[model samples]
Target: MDSEKPREIRIGNAERTTALEALGEHYTIGRLDNAEYSERVDAVTAARTRSELSELFIDLPEPTPFGPGDGSAALTPAARAASAPARIPDRREKVVRTLNLFAGGGTVLVFLLLLALGVPMAWLVFILLPMAYGAIRIWAGPGDVDASGIDSAEQQRRRDVESRRRKELGY
Candidate 1:
């Protein structure tokens, strides 16, 4: 009990019992079905002090026994987490990155082959030089992914795979 609050006592046992009976009647009339009525009854029956009862009633509707009353209660958080997928590790992604890096390699090899086969200087300058530049552009060109809304976790996984391929292929 707060020492600062004014308090009064019901004068007799009859008065207290009558007050409790009246409150119970009011509760029963309030459309509290059996489950709720029983839960509140248990709370009230077990209450040892006025403060405990106050705590029990703090913004709470009558209680009900725990059950799958709603669909939410049926599934656990761990089940939700497990159902959500982890990122797919892209095994074939390395092949695309390798293709990008080596798209230029073929042009280089062809130009070299042409040069060794005594292709004329005028043809090499007009054809091979432009082709070599095009190859470099392809190698160092813009990436497949644009600088847009890439999910970072997936991007990191893809980058890791591409880097592994680069190392393996001695790029």
Candidate 2:
């Protein structure tokens, strides 16, 4: 009869429960510090989950030095990935077009008002008045952000909401 080498019995699921109970006892009796106890306990718990632990084997070092294989070529800066292009604004273009339409409409309305009020042809000069006023107001630059002018309550609420959104997104 041949006497062969004895095989080892791998620890099973029930053994895991006993191990955990022992680990908890060690913690409760002050045999280990909280941080060390938790780390060791987590390690044993992690060891029993086979399929989950299998992921830990990926690209693991084998106690030997290694580097990138010599066959592959490295890419230069100009050959790297490019960003997606920005689209130009159609919205602002339409706003300018609408402003032109508003100017023409204002002229027609002024002419009609003069005729209705029984004014003479010389009143046609009034047609340019609103357009000139609008040009001067626009060229004077944007108005000041005076606290007394605009209602501060709603503006404060909008700023708070924007700040909260930024914080929640972790930016």
Candidate 3:
């Protein structure tokens, strides 16, 4: 009996790009050093077949361009979501968001009231200031810790205090 051989699939630029991105992640997490990363990147760029790209990641971990079945690219959606970092909004973020909502609504109401009362357009500045202030506060972010100015210990202390305050206030 004659057996049929599977065809070797050639990779495209998209596959090469995916391989580079995966290699970048591995390098960022310190899995590959500078020399090894450079070598793998060169190989990925020059690689023609899916098997060539797959071989580059054989020594590495998951999140590779090639999967177990037929060199399929990328993680499953569930796996991608699971790997992503969770960003839980803290108490200060919650407060800022709430205040922004109120500020926006109040600004609109005042603007309409001024317009109905035949006030000069210049008076709109008064309605706009609170909104501007809210925008600035939101842009500045949480005030509990100054990431650049504070030492690690002080920053930790501030975070602890903020956490305690949030717990006490039921936030």
| TM-score on alpha carbons, each prediction | 0.22, 0.24, 0.39
lDDT of 1: 0.44
Instruction: Report clash pairs, candidate 2.
Output: none
Q: What is the C-alpha RMSD of each candidate to the true structure, in Å?
A: 24.7, 21.5, 14.6
Error of 1 at 138 (Å): 93
Residues 54-118, candidate 3: write the lDDT tens digits. Answer: 88876555668865553333456575444433446666666777777867676677777878888
Score candidate 1 by TM-score against the native. Answer: 0.22
Error of 3 at 27 (Å): 0.5
In candidate 1, what are the lDDT values of residues 42-126, reduced to their tens digit? 5544555444344433332222111123123344667644433343424334445555565566557766777888876634554
Most accurate candidate by lDDT: 3
Order the candidates by TM-score, highest first.
3, 2, 1
Per-residue error (Å), model 3, residue 122: 67
Candidate 3 Cα errors over 4 Å, as ranges: 1-4, 68-171
Regions of model 2 farther than 4 Å from truth: 1-6, 48-171
lDDT for 119 (candidate 1): 78
- Scanning candidate 3 in windows of ten residues, the lowest lDDT window is 143-152
